[model samples]
Target chain A: MEQKTAIEAFAALAQETRLGVFRLLVQAGPDGLTAGDIAAHIGVPASTLSHHLGILERAGLLRSWRVQRQIYYATDYEGTRRLLAFLMEDCCRGLPELCGTALSDLVACCPKPTVDA
Target chain B: MEQKTAIEAFAALAQETRLGVFRLLVQAGPDGLTAGDIAAHIGVPASTLSHHLGILERAGLLRSWRVQRQIYYATDYEGTRRLLAFLMEDCCRGLPELCGTALSDLVACCPKPTVDA
Candidate 1:
């Protein structure tokens, strides 16, 4: 991703409400959550949640699709990966060894959720 | 890093000038670059660069240490790593395999510089 888009993405995430919303969506995975569900989950008013979702959508950090009468929100995983790559592009002077342990730990700790049953 | 600090860091990085300064520092590695040098490299006025640097420093994305009269700036690798990890903690629903290819490509493309000479 270019610097401008990266900045926008970062800006979208640089908020308490938005970050919570984004994280909730990430946890929800590709299945995503409806706008009403997100508002309830984050304990934010519908209007406030709408504003936050708009920011995330504008930043390209999220994607929404209508399933029946509900709009589902999900993380744009590719966009997020691009943003992370851009931020860490020169990480530890490009020496993955310098960042390997941390990256490994992150991966380990962030294991994908199994069946929600 | 906590959410608050992460938000601050993201806010610091959300700007054009500050992001330029931070990326310059990230590229500069542990040796860092002096404020004057950064101003020169990014072609911004000293005063403007100073403001940008101050924002970055306050957000903990950049660290400065004085060596002689020159203040060198470097990326806080740990801080950065923490931020990236936080953002990607639930990436692809914790499926590293989903992010592995992109992550590997990023690491490969960002190899550390061998020597300045």
Candidate 2:
């Protein structure tokens, strides 16, 4: 990710509401979740959720598709991966060993949790 | 890694000068680079570099200490790792295989480069 897009993606994830929404979507995995479902799960009003979704979409952290009347939201996996790589590119310098334990724990703890719509 | 700190860190990295300074620090590794050296490498004026450094420091992306008359700045490896983990917590969902190549490449390409002060 270039600096501009990295900044945008990070900014999108910077907010509390948006961060929760993105985390939920991440946990939802590739199957994704519907707009209504996300709003319900997050306990935010649909109107407010709509605004947060717009920010995430513009930042390229999310992708959406419509199935019938419902809009499904999924984490932009590639975009997120790029952002993560950018952040970790120089992590612990050349001492990967220093960061190894933490890295593995993160990967283990955050395994994709599929959510059915 | 909370919402507030993440926002501040991301905002600090959002700008061109600040980002450049950060990348320089990342490349410089744990041994770090002097403030003057960073300014010279990034081609930003001392006064301007000071401001940018201040932002990175305030955001916790950087740490600094004085060695004689020079102040050395280095990437906060722990802070950076947290940020990266946060971004990648759900990357490629359950398909770590999908992101493995890119992640490894990032690790290889950005190995820490030490600068002698």
Candidate 3:
């Protein structure tokens, strides 16, 4: 991602409501949630939530699709991956001993759910 | 990390200069760089860089220490971990099948430098 794009993504996540919306959609998974459900879950006004959603979409952190009269929103996995890649680009700049484990541990803390369990 | 702290960190990183500084320091590794060096590398006036550095430091994304009269800055590994953890908290929220690989693929993209190499 370019610096401008990265800045926009960071700005999108910098706000409380937008961050909440992103995380909510992330937890909602591929199926996503309708605008009404998101507003209800976040206890925000529909109009206000709509504004936040637009910002997130523009920043590439979210993808929204219209289903019937309602709109569904989900995390944009590819956009997210791009942002993460930009952050870790040339991480530690060759000092593997210092950051190899540190970066890995970021995701390690939240274990991926097992299929059998 | 609390929503407030996460917001602060994201906000700190949202700007062009601040983000550049953080990424530069990350590349610099644990030994960090002096404030003068950061200013010179980023091509910003020392006073302006100082302000940006303060915001980043307060947001917990960077740490600074005094080495003689020069203050050195480096990425704060703990704060970074907390932010990443917060982002991935309850990821997919039980829908492992959808996000199991997606989240892991984040750090996986940047191959850690091998010790023997």
Best by DockQ: 3
Give the C-alpha miss distance for residue B92 in model 1, angstroms. 5.2
The RMSD (Cα, Å) of candidate 1 is 8.4
Off by over 4 Å in 3: A107-117, B107-117
User: In model 3 chain A, where is the ten-residue run with the lowest total lDDT?
Assistant: A108-117
lDDT score, candidate 2, position B24: 70
In order, what lDDT does every prediction score? 0.71, 0.69, 0.78
Report the C-alpha lDDT of model 3 over A29-93, residue by residue, as the tens digit. Answer: 77899999999999999999999999999999899899999999998877887776666566666
Tens digits of lDDT, candidate 1, A1-117? 689999999999999999888877765667789999999998999988999899999898999999899999988876776676566555455544544454433322112211111
Docking class of 2: incorrect
Cα lDDT, model 3, residue A4? 92
Best by TM-score: 3
Could you give candidate 2's per-residue lDDT for residues A11-58 as a string of tens digits? 787677888898788656667899999999999999999999999988
Compared with the true structure, what per-residue lDDT tens digits does model 2 show for residues B5-104?
7677777887778877887776565778999999889898899999999989988889999999999998776676566555445444445454344333
Query: What tens-digit string does per-residue lDDT give for candidate 1 at B1-117?
Result: 578888998899999988888877765556788889999989999888888888888887877899899888887766666676566555455544544454333322112211111
What stretches of model 2 exceed 4 Å from their correct place?
A: A90-117, B88-117
The CAPRI classification for model 3 reads as acceptable
Q: For every candidate, how close is chain A to the native chain A in TM-score?
A: 0.81, 0.79, 0.86
Cα deviation of B5, candidate 3, in Å? 0.5
Candidate with more favorable, higher DockQ: 1 or 3: 3
